[model samples]
Target chain A: MSNASTRNRGIPNPLAWIGAAALGLFGEIGRLAVFSARVKAAAFSPRWYIGQIWKQIVQIGFFSLPVVGMSAIFIGAALALNIYQGSGRFGAEQFVPNIVVLGITRELGATITALMLAGRVSAGISAEIGAMRVTEQIDALESLSASPYRYLYAPRFLAALIALPLLVLVADIIGVMGGWAVSVFGLGFDSTVYLRNTLDFVTRNDILTGLIKAVVFGAVIALMGCYQGDRSKAGATGVGRAATLSMVGAAVLVLASNYIMSTIFVEVGL
Target chain B: MTTPILSLQNVEKRFGKNHVLRGVTLDVAPGESLVVIGGSGSGKSVMLKNALGLMTPDSGKILFNGEDVTQAKGKTRARMRERVGMLFQSGALFDSLTVWENVAFRLVNSGVVSRAKAKDRAIETLSKVRLGSDVADLYPAEISGGMQKRVSLARSIISKPDLIFFDEPTTGLDPITADAINDLIIEQVRGLGAATVTITHDMASARKIADEVAMLFEGEIIWRGKASDVDNSGNPYVDQFVHGRAEGPIQPAL
Candidate 1:
């Protein structure tokens, strides 16, 4: 009550709030850059922790296959139905198989697989690492004279970077089959004819472009996870916040990078 | 003069506006047991961390034997850390690694021993801590808190370093278990002939494991002497802390 007479009664100071937000964002970006540099330096050092990398590959790559396959299959089925309906209006329903294969191979398969992994792998990494951080296991590593970045992060990053492209390749094949199933069973097209149409329409460049997108998205997902967890504050609440931020950040970065990469692919005529 | 095994010279550290450590200076002679006793948030951990080179001091130097290792970087830091082990307050055992793997971490991680030999050594170390063969293959999460603490102790002493830091080794255990842990720690340190620095709020633990004790209060070492003299030291803050007083020079943080 004493301070009420001295305070401004009108609107909030938008510029001050906006400026503070901008500064905070810049600080975060700067921290991430330094962390990435340390990762690069650690990469050049000996003792790469290949055992840890293998464990992570099995965890992130092999275990994620079923979920990725399921999503790709559903995406293919949904795309076939949508494309068939739209093409039907133009009396070009015959192009359904061709378009479905082309769509999955060129973009949808890779982007969807990456986004799925951003939720699964990235969030898992942040939570695990953040918990280690708060509990001082990371400090324990330092006490043991080991680099936490090398022992903890490098392996996960390498696994995600390797796993995404492989997963994307798997997604492409499964997605095409899914579209074929929908075309044959749901749309009443002949199975052999639909398969032939997909094969004929799909190109090497389309498959490679999707794989490339997957690799970039993979790095973004793992890097953001490691970054958030590395700088995590104290307590259970802090770990939870780190995991949430890592997942959201990874998903957003994946989507944004997907758009940019797709545009680059188109511009380059790939 | 033979240099002390560890030395902190006027070291200071601040986090944001909070000065956790202020001009801390201390030394541990070879094979000596020095326990730091402080209330929660009294900068005891920060002092130990600075000495271990886990956290750099805002000012002054940390000398290990003779060389300054405040930065804890490169070959010198590595060589220094080779003879150092820290038992964290929370047991801080890597959850992903099994008990044997956790104990043998330093050896396997640094390639000092083959994986096959490390497992055998881990089991041997576990036995020293009075844990049975059944405990080795279990994950940290699969064990009780007491078991986890024992495992952590085993890990710390597995490498048999010359200088060790034990952070609250008996914090959560019951009286019997706490005594058991203190006994285990004593056995390990004596067997290694190591200089020890332990931080705890437990007077019983300090009395049991320490040859000398230091009290961290208001970001400084306010009182220190022979462990036997702690009860009669007479400093109000140390008196309040040692007796677990509700009202004294040391106010509740809230």
Candidate 2:
């Protein structure tokens, strides 16, 4: 066949794939539009939005506390044990308290814990929203003139943004407590000394940096969750893909962003 | 004739190698009811999608209110949509919302009424469809298929749209409920003076609600005439489809 006829006769390979991707993306954007329209059309006054916010606070913040706390405690204990063993070989056993404080507060506590939370929250958000989209509820909203984004995504995003930091803060505190427990009990260090050292080792900058990471991680998780879920296609299979992608993608991205943010923070001398 | 509320001029749409719509042209004048009758996969759904701007046509002019609406975008598209309503094949009511909320959706989106007022309007619309106000609080899943269809209908007409499209509106309902819905559709269209275009395989519905009927076969309208002429169109394809015959001009799918 001539090249012109070849081109005219069938779907272009690259164009077909591009068109498929575009259709998927457009479906998501359409969903977002429908979500926003539904909210606008719902006459959900300021009171309704506020109520939604409150609901988010409970769902995102309160419900996440136990997991964040447990994960942080276990991580802190494991780090302390590892540091104590390494320091002992160097005849630097006394350095265990300082290393525990520095490691848990400076990097591991917020970064690792936030990564876990991102996987949990993002996967949940994506699955819930993806299922809703797959089932035609989103279309119903559009037919009714409601915007799905404002109705569905906005409140969830806000909840994650607000609740995640609080969860991280709890995790940070519990993590320090875990480190203290190990330093005092396993290492046979004086409780008072370990407490003083932890207090002295932790700078205001360390806490602030962790909180900032928490906030950034929260936004990333929410964005990925909403994007993947809202854009899902092909029913259950699509929803399953959305949930998996949201979790795995959020976990990887959160860790990667933590490293980048940490580098920027150190370079800026903050 | 009063200006056609909707007009499709040589509209065409194709999906990959499959041509769904082949230079289809039709019109719905003000307050008129036009039904496009065809078998499954005959491009009836695609035609409605094209008119609704859900699917972009490869070529054609769709004039709404005498203005080219084929490629209207942003605010213009939104405004055009605000005056139009659609009933999807599956009722497609939001499972998360109550019946009243679904019915009140367009009214709320118009940003012209308070929530209290919108709810009241929704309830009134529901009542018009013979659904009690008590049904308004029920989720879509809580209702029977017929009731859900009624709620869907209520949602469609609540906006009092100038143009409406019904996709297989009576498809899943039993004979009695389907007839009731068809009558309600006719009553509402007449009452609101809104132009309507319905696509269906149901000849009885076409006869009841259509002022004019067009038969779509193999991506083209093979017959077009007044509703009364459907049975006597003398077109083999139309006869086959209307009678649900197995063997005719439309070969069975292999």
Best by lDDT: 1
Q: Can you give the lDDT of residue A212 in candidate 2?
A: 87
Candidate 1 per-residue C-alpha lDDT over B109-228 given as tens digits, one digit per residue, 9 for 90 to 100:
889799999999999999999999898899999998889999999999898898999999998899999999999999989999999999999899999999999998878999999999
Model 2 residue A233 distance off true place after TM-score fit, in angstroms: 2.1
Residue-wise C-alpha lDDT for candidate 2, range A89-133, written one tens digit per residue: 879877776777677766777777777777678888898788777
CAPRI grade of model 2: acceptable
lDDT of 2 at B154: 88
Q: Roughly what TM-score does model 2 have, to 2 decimal places?
A: 0.83
- The positional error of residue A64 in candidate 1, measured at the CA in angstroms, is 0.7
Native contacts present in candidate 2, fraction: 0.42
Q: What residue runs in model 1 are displaced by over 4 Å at the alpha carbon?
A: A1-11
* Candidate 1 DockQ, CA atoms: 0.88
Which DockQ value does candidate 2 get? Answer: 0.37
Best by DockQ: 1
Residue A202, candidate 1: C-alpha displacement in angstroms: 1.4
Model 1 per-residue lDDT at B217: 85
Residue A53, candidate 2: C-alpha displacement in angstroms: 4.9
